[model samples]
Each structure stands twice: as C-alpha cells, then as structure tokens.
Target chain A: MPLRTLLQADDVRRAITRMAHELVEHDPDADRLLLLGIPTRGAVLARRLAAEVARIAGREVPVGVLDVTLYRDDLGTQPTRATGRTDVPADVDGATVVLVDDVLFSGRTVRAALDAVTALGRPAVVRLAVLVDRGHRELPIRPDSVGRNLPSAKSERVRVLLTETDGRDEVTIE
Target chain B: MSDHLLSTRDLSRDAAVALLDVAEDMADTQRRTVKKLPTLRGTTVVNLFFEDSTRTRISFEAAAKRLSADVITFSAKGSSVSKGESLQDTAQTLQAMGADGIVIRHQASGAAAVLATSGWTRAAVVNAGDGTHEHPTQALLDAFTIRKRRFGAGSRGRDLAGLDVVIVGDVLHSRVARSNVWLLTTLGATVRLVAPPTLLPTHIESWPVEAGTDLDAAIADGPDVVMMLRVQRERMTEAFFPSAREYAALYGLSAARADRLRADALVMHPGPMNRGLEIAGSVADSPRSTVLEQVENGIAVRMAVLYDVLAGERTA
Candidate 1:
C-alpha cells in the first residue's frame, strides 16, 4: 500500500500545456473538435484540456463526459462498478472527437469509450488523448496525444489525482 | 449486493439507498439522445411472467432493452405454462438457453423467492411482482419518484428521513403496499396504512407501519406522500367492501380529499386504477400526482435493480 509521487503539480500543468499545443498543431480547426472526458478523473482532465485548448485557440471547445461503465466488455467478469453520467453536449456527427482520459493502461477503457461515443452519434473521426500512457495495452489502441509515457509493471497501479475531485493535482504510483 | 431482488426485506438500508442513487444515474441517461447503454449487450434477459401484467412487464422489458440486453418476453397464457408445465421446468429451460437475468411475475406468492433460492436457474431473479407477497421494483420506483419530487436533484445519496407516507386502499391484496411499507420504512420514512377493516390484512399488526381504518384521519396528518393501491375488482369475488360508491365516499382520494392534503403532499397510484373506486379522476390527474412519474421512474429503478443483481459484486 505504499504511495510515491510520480508527477508533481507543475509537471501536470506543463504536460497539459504541451498536449494542448500539440492538439492545435495537429488540427487547426478548433470549431469541429470536441473533447469528451471519460468519467471520474477523465472528466476532470477533459475540462482542464478544454481550458488549455481555449487558452491556445481563443475559441471554446465543447467538452462532455462519457461514462464507459455500461459499454465495457468485461462487465460481469469483473464486478461492475456503478456507471457515471454520460453527457454529450453536441451532436457528434462529422466532428472529430478526442476521447480524454487520465491514464491509459490496458486500452480496454478507451475501447469501451469508443463504443460509447459511437453509440451517441457517428463522428467524422475519433482520436485518443491521455494524460499518461503506462503501456501494457491489451488492445491495439494508441493515444494520439499523451501527456507522459511512464512505463511500469502491470502489478503497479497508477493513480491520477485532480484538484476538482481529489483536491490535489499529482500522479502517483502505488 | 444480493444476486436477486425478491423482497424488500432482503434489502439493507445502504443497499436500498445505493439502488436509488444508481436509478438517478439511469434517469440522467434518459435525457440523452442515445438512451441505450452497452452494459448488458451480450447479456440476455428473459421477462418470465406466469401471470398477466402490463405495466410491470413493459417496465422491465424497457429497462432491459435500454441497457442493451436481448429481451425475450414469456407469458403463461398460450405458452407451455398453460399446458400445466411447472415453474421449475420453465426456469430450467431458460437457464439452458443462457439467460443472464430473469424478471418474473407470478400469480402465486413466494414464486420469485423459490426461483431465486432454487437451483433451477443461475440467472439473477428480479421479482416484478409475486402475487401479493412483494413487488420490490414498484416500491423502489415509488420511493425514487417521491424522493425526486421532494428533494429534486439533491436526492442523490439521500434517504427519506423524517418523511411521512400514507398507503391507502386494498392492503389485503397489494404487493405494492407490502413492499412500500418495508422499503419506505427502511429508508427512514414513517408509513401509515389506511384501509377499511374488510380491505386491511388481518395480520397488519406485524407490519412495520401505523395501521388505521380512517382515511380522513390519515389525510389530516398531512403526509408527504399518499399512495393509493388499486382496488382489484376481479380479486374481490366476495364483497370486500359493501359497494364501490360507499368505498369511494369513505376512502377514495376525491378532489375534496386532495384539496385537504398539504400542497407538498404527493398522490401516487400503482396503476390500472379503478378511477372512481380508490381515487378520483381529478385527483389521479392532479399536479401533485406522481402516477406518471412512477411509471417513468419504474424503468430506471428496474434498470438499477437489474444492474445491481446481475452485474454488481456480491458483497453479502
């Protein structure tokens, strides 16, 4: 049950800023872009990313929360957790959707999120963005925008704490 | 979490509250353009009814479908059950066909309990309504509606502490009343059961509720919710009440009785109502009536129940 701080508050801020710049560079059209955060910390990270995007592009990007709990494939296999709210602000039809998450591990979460997003509406393109990519991906999915690529053992758990929910901004390993 | 929702008595305070909170999330899903969830996509849910029902059956069906589960509806009439096939045989057949969940409504009390405890089926058993024993889902939805009406969006993680609820009409044959009395009380609501002597159950003293024969007296208490149970005329082969007109005069939620209620007091009905028999048409359709809300919440509540029983971790 030991906890060690992996990324400090300043590191998270800098990583987000860099990711925002990369997103702007990759896609100049901010109007057709929508950032949907996976629930829990993913949602908080999405809001932060949206703010960062607004700061860089000077245009507000629509952000929504996508709960992948119900869309998960391993529902009954692993004890199913309660589902969070899925709120998509705009019609996703023909829009580039960047699925945001705090951590990227097995890629199963992103896969579930993709299913959830597609069920909402047919997007022109769907992209993946993560604050941290900790490898050990069981699925063939990769993040387009990654804040950090911290390789670690599969036995270890990466915990991302945000000020919105956890009252602190830091990444930890336990 | 239990694997089956057979009775409200099996629900702990925390479990009951958790189910309600999950239902709130389900309700939130209803507002979205894509109301379907992928949670139960590969899962199969069978609506197994050994009795006739419209609302409860449809509510469970809608709930299962919304969760993206394949739903197969089985009615007793025109089915193998009408050919004198037993409940165990039918349940085993469903199990063999790979049903992950069974939402059952039966004419006999304790049928759901038997299906849940017996090893005939491995699927999670959700009692839509089992005779007059209990309709746990109905009570859950009723509680959800009441909590939503009283607390609005702040109802999450909240219990009905210090709330007053009065259940009226044919208590002798009402699974809704039995379930509500147990669940509402468990959620910290003080319940008062009002029915005529003939309509009230003989063993009412054992129930965890204040029992009374005077509807006016109970209404005078200004309860937070007034739930009217349907008067099953078909069930009453012998005269339970002297006449429908006399019952309406004494116990029916007339417009006058509705006016006597506090402005905040909500009216409820487990429907297929005998309009003028147990409740007045005006009162049933009144602004305070959560009748329609109950029907709507029924889907969300059943979804929560199905989720908790089938997908949730078995903690107990």
Candidate 2:
C-alpha cells in the first residue's frame, strides 16, 4: 500500500495549538474541565492538550487516560488485543469532561469511551474532541472540538502518529 | 490462540505474553473504586468443579464477576454428578442452560480436554485444575506474579527469558508442578525440579527440566523464583518419603533454607499449604513470598484467559 502524508509535524502542532485555544475560549473556568484521552495515541494527545490548555489558561487542567477496549462492542468479532491503562486521576462527577482522541472516524470508540466514563462516574457534561475528524462516523456522535477536518474514503486508513507513542508527529493515509 | 486453554503446552510464546499483558490490565482495575468492566456484561460463565477448591473456584468467580459476566457455580457434591451422571451429561446440561464459558476443575486428568473437544458445549473451556495433568491458570498466575515482582512496571511484553526457577516438592501427584515446568520452560526460564526419588514422577527424564534430589543444591544456584508445591497428606498412602519429619528435613523449605536464599529471590507456593511439611510458616509468610500475590494474580490471569477465549478473535 502506498503512503500519503495528510498532516506533517508542523501542521499537527498548529492544529493542536488552535484546538487548545478553542478549548480555552469555550471554557472560561478551565479548572472545571478535564481532558481524557482514549488510550494508545489519545492519551498522548490528551497530555499534549492539557499542556496547551495550561499554557493558554495559566492553570493546569487535569488529564486522564480512558481505555475503551473493555467497553468495545466488537470485542469478539475483531482480533483481541491487550487492554491499555484506564487511569482517571480524580472523580469526574459534576466535571465537564472533554473526551480526546487522535482521529475520529467511526465514532464507535467515542461511544465505547462514553460507556466506560459513565460506568466510572457521572460527569455534568461530556464533550468530544479529536485531533483529526475523518468523516466516516457510524454512531450518532460528533466531536465538539476538532483540530483538523480531513475527509477521506472509508476504505482508506487514517494513521495518527504522535511523538510520545510513535517517536514522530505525523498523520498518514494509506 | 485455541478457543480452549486446556494446558500450558497449547500456548505459544506470543499468546502467553499476550495473556500476561492482559492480566496486567485486569490487575490495574483492582486499584479503581469501581473495579467492574462492561466487557462481558451479557455473557454467562459456569464454574463446573468435580473437585473441591476454595481459592481456584473463588478466583474464577471473582474474575467472572469483575468482568460483569453472570456466574453459576456447580459443584459435583450436590449436583447430578454425585448421583452417577457422566461428565457429558453435566456439561450438556450446562450448555443447554446457555453457558458462554465453563471454568472446569476435575479429578480426571483429561476431563477439561474432553469438555473442550467433546462437542457437548460451545462455551470456552478453561481448565482450572485437572487431576495430575495440568493446572494452566495456576501457572499463569505464578508467572504473572514472578514477572511483576522481578520486572515491576516494565514487565509488559516480556517473557521469563534466562530466569532460573526452582520448583520443589511432590512432582509425582502435583498438577501445579507439571504445569509450571512446561510453562516456565516455554517462557525461556530454566526450571529445576527438587524432589525425593519416590516423590518424583516416573519417566521424569522425559520432561524438559533439570531434576535434582538436593534442595540445598538447587537453592545454592541462586534461582530467581522458588515455587513449592503442596504436599497432600491425604495422598500419602504408600509413603513417598520415610516420614513427614524426614520430608521436612530434606525437601521442605525451612526457615534456615529460606534465610540462605538470595534476598531478591521470590518464594512461591500453590496454596492450601501444608505449613510445616512443605514450606515453613515463616518462609510462606516472608516478604519474599508471593503466595498472597499469586492468589490475587489468579483472578486477573483467569480473567485474561476467559476474555481471550470468549471475546478474543479466533486465531487462524
């Protein structure tokens, strides 16, 4: 399969900076906001977003990692992989949670993340955030904060590589 | 990636590592206030035991419950099996009742294998313990505990490569010993069996492990893990050793021998311990001991096994 560079490192940085600004603009009280990254790359993205939010708001925003593997509906149908860490640093009750992911495609992952988060505690408001919003959503869910909107065919895979996980920041389509 | 985990031999290096990694995730769940996962919400797991077990049974039950699976425990004591019903009958009945997974512990050597292949049920068969043949889950938990203690947080995706493990006790009647020998060896660990001539199994040379009659010699090798098998007093009909005292003198892990072990070396026991006979109480309760951790790891390991069998994608 041939590889295509959808977003370079500078592009990803710009997108993240803009998304962080958008997040700070929407939430005047950033202390009540919690950024939770879905595992693998999402957790890394959440950390990056938290840093960006801290830079803009001048206050630290709590970041947590939520692994949606256990809440996934396609567990038996797809190949089983090892579950990642689901570490919610604090009680999310009455907190506005921004569920962050690297790429938003089918939206099933976000749905699973919702199920996982709901099981932990009741958040006052749960919003979705994605670095790249690739339009192929199957579930009735949409990202509240999107870094980049990249429309592509459903057959093409959108691979998001972060420096923390993949040792480089780039988005690829193959 | 076979649907059924009948023996340790059935697991490849990658599969075993994957199971351990998954168990680590399960262990992570225990730290949370809400330790339940929505993975197997609608699935039903049946604990079918022909033999009496407290730890293994409870571990499986807790594992299944933690994963949000409905659990039904059926022991042979009050069940139809006590009334002369065959294994096939009981299994078929459980299958008819819509069991998604069956964690079976039987006194027969191949009972679990039979259930997995007999077409009596489509549910995944996890062998908790089967006679003197294998206790796959015990070995898995033991491995998990050992790896966790040795490597800490960096234990993920790692095997027991080059680690020396000494399994001491009744190898003849111990399914724990049998399972650990295969699994530890397969994971690239050097395994040595320390037992008396009578306590050792027949044709033991066929096994891929170093056999020795001296406990002190095995301990002097500075093993990373020392796993002591239980010595059942009830199974000692023909006298495997001269007496309990002599067995304790030679093969038993006394306090003195425990002190001689390397500070980092871990002491392990498959539980329901014969306190004074196989391992001294101090050693069993020592800081180096992984007995309690093994029990805790049992739930996570069994959870991983069930998840792999029931929810994991089938391997081609």
Candidate 3:
C-alpha cells in the first residue's frame, strides 16, 4: 500500500500552536487546567502541546500520563496489553481536564480514558484534544479540539510520528 | 505465557521476565488508593485446593479480586472431595459452572498437570503447589522481590543474572525449593542447595544446581541471597533429621549466622515458618529479611499470572 502524508513537520507545529491557543481561550482558568496524555505517541504530543500552551498563556499547566490499557473493554477477547505509568500530577477535582492523543479513530481509547480519569478523581469537566481526527468513531464521542480532520476509509491505517519518539514529525495514512 | 502454568521448568527467560515486568505494573497500581482494575471483570476464577494453605489461597484470592474477577474457593476438607468425589468430577462440576480459570493446590504431585492436559476442563490451570512438585507463582514472587530489592525502579525487563543464591533445608518436600531451583537457574542465577543428606532429594546430581551439606560453608561464601526453607513436620512420615535442636544448630539462620552474612545479602523465607527451627526470630524480623516483601509480591505476581493465562495470548 502507498503511504500518503497528511501533515508535514511544519504543518504539525502550526496545528499544535493553534490548538494550544484554542484550549487557552476556551478555559481561561490556567490554574485549574490539566493536560493528560495517552501512552506512546500520545504522551509526546501531550508534552509538545504543554510547551505550546505555556508559550501562549504565559503560564505552565500541569501535565501527566494516563494509560487506559487496563480499562479497555476487549481485555479478555484480545491479547492483554502492558500497562504504562499513570502519573496524576494535580488534584483532578474541579479541574478542566484535557485528554490529548495522537490520532482519534474508534474512540474506544477515549472511552477507556474517560473511565481511567473518573477512577482517579472527579473533574469539573473533561474535554479531548487530538492531533489527527480520522473519523470512525465507534462510541458517541467527539473531539473538542482537532489539529487536522482527515476523512479516510476503514481499511486504511493512520499513524502519527513525533520527533520525541520516532525522530520525525508527521501524520501519514497508508 | 503458556495456557497453563504448571511448572517453572516450562518458562523461558523471556517469558519469566515479561511476567515480572507486568508484575511491576501491578505493583505500581497497588500503590494507588483505587487499586482495583476492570481488566477481568466478567471472568470467573476458581481456587481449587486439595491441600491446606493460608497465604497462597489469600494471595490468589486478592489477586483475582483486584482484577475484578469473581472467585470461588474450594477446600478438600469440607468440599465434596471428602464425600468420595474424584478429581475429574470436581473439575467437571467447576467447568460446568463456567469457571474461566482454576488455581489449584493439590496433595498429589502432577495433579495440576493432569487437570491442564486431561481434557476435563477448558479453563486455564495455575499450580498453587502440588505436593513437592512445583509452585511457580511463589518462585516468581521471590524473583520479583529479589529484582525489586536489587535494582529498585530499574528492575523492569531484567533477570537475576550473576546473583548467587543459597537455598537451605528441607529440599525433599519443598515445592518452593523445586520451583525456585528451576526458575532462578533459568534466569541466570547460580543456586546452591544446602541441606542434610536425608533432606536432599534423591538424584540431586542431575539437577542444575550445586549441592552442599554445610550451611556455614555456604554462608561464609557470602551469597547475594540466602533463602530458608521451612521444616514441614506434618509431611515428615520419616525422620529426615536427627532432632529439631540439631537441625536449628546446623541449618537455622540464627542471629549469629545472620550477622556473619554480608550487609547487602538478602534473607528470604517462604511462609509458615517454624520461627526458631529454620530461622531465628531476630533474623526473620531484621532489615535484611525479605519475608514480608515476598508475601506482598505474591499478590502482584499471581495477578500477572492470572492475566497471562486468562487474558493474554500464549507467548510461551
């Protein structure tokens, strides 16, 4: 299969900057804002977005990692996955929590993340931010902020590569 | 990652390390206030024991409960096994009740192996301990405890390589010793079995371990870990040693013996200890002892094993 580049390094950077500004604008309370990244590529994207948020809002937001492997619904039917570290930095109660991920596909991951976050503590509100939104949501979930809305077929694979993990910054569909 | 964990002899180095790494994750989850996970929510686990056990049963129960699996415990003393029901009948009855996993501790050796391979039930079989055959989870917990103490946070994806381990006393009827011998050796640790001639198993020369009769000589060598095996009085149909006092004097980890050990050397004991017979009370309570840590790690290791058998694809 041929691979198609959806967003290059510059495009990725520009999109992240825009998303960061949008997050700051939506929730002006920077003190109550928390950014939690899903594992692997999503975690790197989260850190990058945190840096951009600090640059735009002139204040640092707490960032942590939340892995939803254990909360997955298809645990027994499929192979068991290794759990990543879940480091909740601040008190989640009464906070504006943003779950950041690299790609938004079936939304099962986001569903698990919702449960994982709720299990930690009750947040005032929970929103989602994604770098790429490939629309094939199995759950009734939508991203609050999206970098690029790439409509694609079900058979294709969407992969996001970041400089922190893959030594590059791009989004590809193959 | 086998379908059934009957013995550590079937576990490769990679398989053992993978399980340990997963146990590390489980241990991390235990540090949280909300320690329960919904991974095995709808599955049912049965604890079938033809032998009596306190810590092993509770550890397995806690492990299954933490993962949100329903547990049913069956003991031979009060169960239908006392009414002349055979093993097959009991196993089939549990299978009919929709048991997804069975953790069994039996008095007969190879009982778990038979349950796993006899086509009686489709559920995964985990050997709690079968007679003197093996207790894979206990060894895995011991390995986890050792790795955690030695490497701390850097313990993930590592084996017990180059660690010198000395196992003392009652090897003939110790499933813990048998399991640890295979697992520790497979993980690249050199193990020495120290016991009286009668307590050592027959044909010990064929096992992948160094054997000795003198505990003082083994301790003087300054091993990285000194594990004490409990002297099971109930299992002693024949006198394995001359007397309890002589046994304590020679093989017991007294305060003096513990003091002679290197400061960094770890002291380990599988539970239900005869306090003054196999290990001194002071030594068992000292900072060097990992007996409590072993019990704590047992829950995590059993959780990892249950997850490995019931949820994960077989990697063995």
- Using DockQ as the measure, which candidate wins? 2
lDDT (Cα, tens digit) per residue for candidate 1, span B133-172: 9999999999999999999978888999999999999999
Ranking by TM-score: 3, 1, 2
Question: Per-residue CA lDDT of candidate 1, range A1-174, in tens?
Answer: 598999999999999999888888888864699999998888988899999999999989999999888777777766658767677788899998999999999999999988888877799889888999999999999899999999988999999999899998999998
Per-residue lDDT of model 3, residues B67-152, tens digit only = 99999999989879999999999999999999999999999999999999888999999999999899999999999999999999
The per-model DockQ list reads 0.48, 0.60, 0.54
Candidate closer to the true structure by DockQ (higher is better), 1 or 2:
2
Among these predictions, the greatest TM-score belongs to: 3
Candidates 1 and 3 compared: the better one by TM-score is 3
- TM-score of every model versus the real structure: 0.93, 0.93, 0.96
User: Which window of ten consecutive residues has the lowest lDDT sum in model 2 chain B?
Assistant: B307-316
lDDT of 2 by residue, B1-316 (tens): 4588999987888889989998998888777657898888889999998999988999999999999999999999988998999998998999899998899999989999999989888888999989889999999999999999999999999999999999998989999998998888889999999999888888888899999999999999899889998897666778777888999999999999998899999999988999999999989999999999998899999888888887766553
Question: Candidate 2 at A153: error in angstroms?
Answer: 4.7
**What TM-score does candidate 3 reach?**
0.96
lDDT of 2 at A94: 86
Clashing pairs in 3: none
Better of 2 and 3 by DockQ: 2
